[model samples]
Target: MLVVLVHLLFYSCVLSKVYKLQLTHKAKHIHQHKHHKRQNSASLINAQDFDFYVNVTVGNGQVFSLIVDTGSSDMFVRGPGCVSNSGDNSCECDNMLPNPTACVLNTFDSSLSNLSQTAYVQYGSANVNFNIFSGPVLFDGFQITNFPFGSAYQISGLGNSGDGILGLGFNSISRVAWATGKDASIFDALGLTGRQQIFGTYLSNFDFQHFVNDVVGGEITIGGIDNTKFTGPITYVPLISESYWKFNISTLTFSFGGSQPLYLGSSGGGNAISDTGTGQIYLDNSLADRVNSFLGGVYSNVYGSYVVDCKWQNSKIPMIFTLYGVKYSLSSSSYIIPYNGVCLSGISRNGADGHTAFSNFGQVWGRSYYTIYDKFNGRIGFAKAV
Candidate 1:
């Protein structure tokens, strides 16, 4: 019995010294934001079925669509001199979305504001590359000013989602900081804003058969939860790792039609990343193979993902994740994706070596619940999404 323990030791545990920036809001103002407006709410646009994007207003009325990512902690946009990793042939973006002006590189203008220091990030596994410059980032409202962000003029393999990524994770282990040699700001700026130290992600369900780009998807609320998005009250759990919004998932079981739950054979628990950027629920190689095989799925070398029978969509099967002793369940509807005349399994292998159970509770899990990344108290909150 080769039981692999899901462990993600790739993320550094060292906490860096950050120059905290505090945005002081008055007592009455804070109360109103919490009780009245729910504070800093933005609608999410689903980029097909891949991921979600939020349109952000940047320098001098330049509206750029940025992926609302909770897994990473740096914000950058499509800027000038952008090109594909292969060459200058492709810009690695969508085919001209109507609302967002720049569907390609050469969008960001460094001359519009003060720009100094270079930042670059490379996702070796995903084949996405970015070259960035740190500068003052301006928002449309809520007045999150003087936030240091990345202006990526050179990029490749950005995919068809958005112009850039708006990372919402903690800055303690920011890759942008490692790239630019300067403090990465945004989450830090929101933390010191004297309001709620939490932000919520609500990715909506769309028409599976007729999915397309530029559709109203969901919302991202900063400061507090929108009581309307979820049902009942929220259940909060302490974060096991703050660097990447990680928590320990006790077990994963396959249950169907009120039958006895079948364990997918992951033991000693596993650390799962609650990532908005990731679209599929990732499990260890052994565990994923086990789960997919049981679900009548097969691995495709061409796609590099597991493909299950399209009939599995109506199988009434639910994959349950026991997180901190709480069972959070996802129905087949949320886990089975219909793509290009075939159904793609929302679960995939983590691409890590044996004996490690570094799993990920991707956006499919988010579809089952409204997730709150609570920074102040260092915890994650979950509520059944309505």
Candidate 2:
């Protein structure tokens, strides 16, 4: 009996030691994961996704659409369908053209090709095709030199989602640069010597009305922020990580009146991905219905636009996107665009598998947040305001 008792005591001691070690190891892993996640969230925003809209004139006094994007510098348009300045020969755009309204080059330069049917370019997803070309860039009453540009595959609905997309993100985040060998972007051409190249852009009031007209051009000042257009003080956030360009978010809390502030994705390693190319905010689908319920379903999504009841009124829901030990609120107006004073613009879902740009994806933050891609300033800032 004495021998058995001693043996039992030894085994118990050993088991306790093993359990302690296991607990210590798990704690360390949890700490490491949280630290790494925070770093990723901060770096993601540093990636640039800015683009500008423009108007181009074709034959018979017809004006078409164009956009300035650094991601894709090369510009191309449909050779057969679109109107041109004056020639009927095989479509071509050259520097020496008399009118200078040259179409983007359609030649298959091996150096610039990415995919066989489509040119592989980077935007929302990895390893995809982007249509690139060159055309005249007109901004703020100034006709800058004709530069390279590009577009994306068109979705059938969405009320004519413009002719194409103009990428303005930095080369680090651009797919256009990888597809085409042309490294120099419009920002580089407009460089001001010592300062980082800058472009200033302003959207015309008409664009909000959804009509095709000459772009009353905006300023795209590279290397600096356009103080005239943005009135509020800029909030600067650093890009600390790489590859994904994500940063560490301390917390993301949302509140509605007296209810306890709901912590979003605190568990399961949840972090918000900011994308300008995406026109809405995307969250985990599981959280979509919960968030929408909190917002009172402000906009009924139809054809990708919000149709709200003009007399609808609900408690102002506040979403605080916290990063790098700081917090910024998603303004009420930004989250909910009122058709008049009561009706909301819309709320849509966003995701790759079953989500969309309309879901709590791009428009969530894109509509309200004044995203400052100060690549030149070396920091990205988000501020909430009217």
Candidate 3:
């Protein structure tokens, strides 16, 4: 079963001042869902891990959990009768285990909302047709009024894990089309208006000994970076592109037992993008093959991943990535995931679409560093996480 969980991120226009906001961490879980309701009773596998989300109150008092995405630029929630409105009247909602409450949260009421407009978005095989409505969105003690969001009337390919997405990216890629013009992202609506235009993320390591369901230790700061979560001076890298949090990785290498390091070739030295929504790292097929060869990995048709010897899980292999002259290292424990008594390489082959994406630095690189996305400065900062 090969499950590809799609996650997103975003970039916003520049802002004026700097402000600070505290963030809360949302834990991840693996769940099974039926692929087709009537046709096939087989399960659709989800390869990606659950993303980080935050709780926010919408409308009068409708509280829902939404994924904090940096690769996308629209926010929406599942509305009542969404499945019926999905063009294909025969389509039914996937049976989500534990009955995700986030999926069934109060749907946006256009009549009750201050403003309403039509909108649409496509995410990870899910096409959402919705209505954009303005309401007061409350996070912590801060409140923003007339905040634009989507009430999904038609949706497909979305998992039941999260109610919707909170896009932190630029408005250029926003799918929300207002009656008059484009819709501003929540970050742009808040951060560009005399408030701080920066946010930080820290995804904690998952400890097996103290494993707990629905519990995560990571956090995201809205207005500013958290000084307490990181140590040492932060290294800033200029953004190569504002499409995503895109940057350049100068070098990539893998070293085993302190021997000579093998240079990992990334097309054009790798045009990398950082995303909090995606799990695992996706490399070009050539690069992926190189990594698998170095780790003595064998392709598993069952999992569609390169399975390595379980002994490698405890080995001292290290993968290093250099960005902006700064080197970040990932140990064996960071790049290898233990599954079914075997260890699987975290690096996977990118699609053949010809777009080179060093995907999902989270869990591995993110767990080791505190990352800050500075939209105002058009740069990304990293520091050793505490």
Candidate 4:
């Protein structure tokens, strides 16, 4: 972990700061954009599986909405002179921000601030290349000075998720850094450590009736955990890796119609990461095939996902994930999503690397349960969200 401590004396006093911000889940249908051209054609388009974002004000009170992602650790926004792959100069910003018109119309000027460095990051199907600059950042009412962030000059495949991203993962994964080779995340730069290194997420389930009216749901607390968002005892699991919120799982099984439970192989056990950036659960191909076979799900070349029988939408089948001796069950209603009158499995095949990734779509597990990411101790906690 790279830690950069810049001491600034204001009236001969040092500052220690903590902050809390509410996150809202923006659930809406996907719209075609210039950036979408860079993403995979098979990417989930009809599903409501984007990330949650919080309002943040960067330098000079220029506010921007940023996705609060635990899977990545870096912060960036489009800057002046940004152009699309097709050489289009107009970068259409998402309307979710505080002032979309102002944000889209204006850009960050590096001439007025200290140029710290330059960076490039690869996220989802997007590549973000930007200039690093240090300035004041405000979250809620807390303010941090000389905070390093990226001013994107080039980007792709961001979709309409959010204006930018607020990476809450480990600082080691941060792409913004000084030329001297030291890297520090936004949290580290703000000096949030020790017991204050805790944060919680409460994501809301998708409601079909009032789609446009209910886009704002869920909450994210920084610097401390929100006890009110969860119930029952929190089950804390140690992190297996520092890169992402990687953790261990004992077993995975599924039960259907009161039938015998089928045990999926444990080959990819203890090697899973909880990611808020992605929309669905990605398991190793072998495990994914087994689950799909049992669910009568077939790979659709049109959607690039497994489509199961729509009748199973109300089935009693439950997918269970046992972690740290605690069994978390995801009801059929939670794992199966309805798209275009067809039912699609929330579970997807992992990459060739064979690592399992539990994402926000699978976070139907979190919908019924609250999740906590403890950066101080490098652990994750879960409790009933009710």
Best model number under lDDT: 1
What tens-digit string does per-residue lDDT give for candidate 3 at 36-75? 0000000111223335555566766675656566667777
Stretches off by above 4 angstroms in model 2 are 1-52, 56-63, 67-118, 121-146, 151-159, 192-221, 230-232, 240-250, 265-276, 298-320, 324-327, 337-347, 352-367, 384-386
User: Which is the better candidate, 2 or 4, if ranked by lDDT?
Assistant: 4
Question: What do the candidate models score in CA lDDT, each in turn?
Answer: 0.58, 0.34, 0.56, 0.57
- Can you rank all candidates by TM-score, best first? 1, 4, 3, 2
Runs in model 3 lying further than 4 Å from the true structure:
1-49, 84-102, 105-116, 124-126, 177-183, 191-195, 214-216, 250-265, 300-304, 339-342, 352-360
Global CA lDDT computed for model 1? 0.58
Tens-place lDDT per residue, model 1, 34-109, is 0012245556655444566655556555666666667677777765666566643324554344363455433345
What tens digits encode model 4's per-residue C-alpha lDDT throughout 1-386?
00000101111012243333433333433211100001000001112443455566786767776655667777777677766677432245666433242343144444236465788877644677877766776665656666677777777656545566667677677776533243456556656557666666666555545544224456555555566667779888888777778776545455555556656536355366666555556666666767777689997756546799977767877777655457777777767766666777777665445553432223445555677778778798888776
Best TM-score goes to which candidate? 1
C-alpha RMSD of each candidate structure in angstroms: 10.5, 21.1, 8.9, 8.9
lDDT for 386 (candidate 3)? 80
The TM-score of candidate 2 is 0.55
| Model 3 quality (TM-score) | 0.76
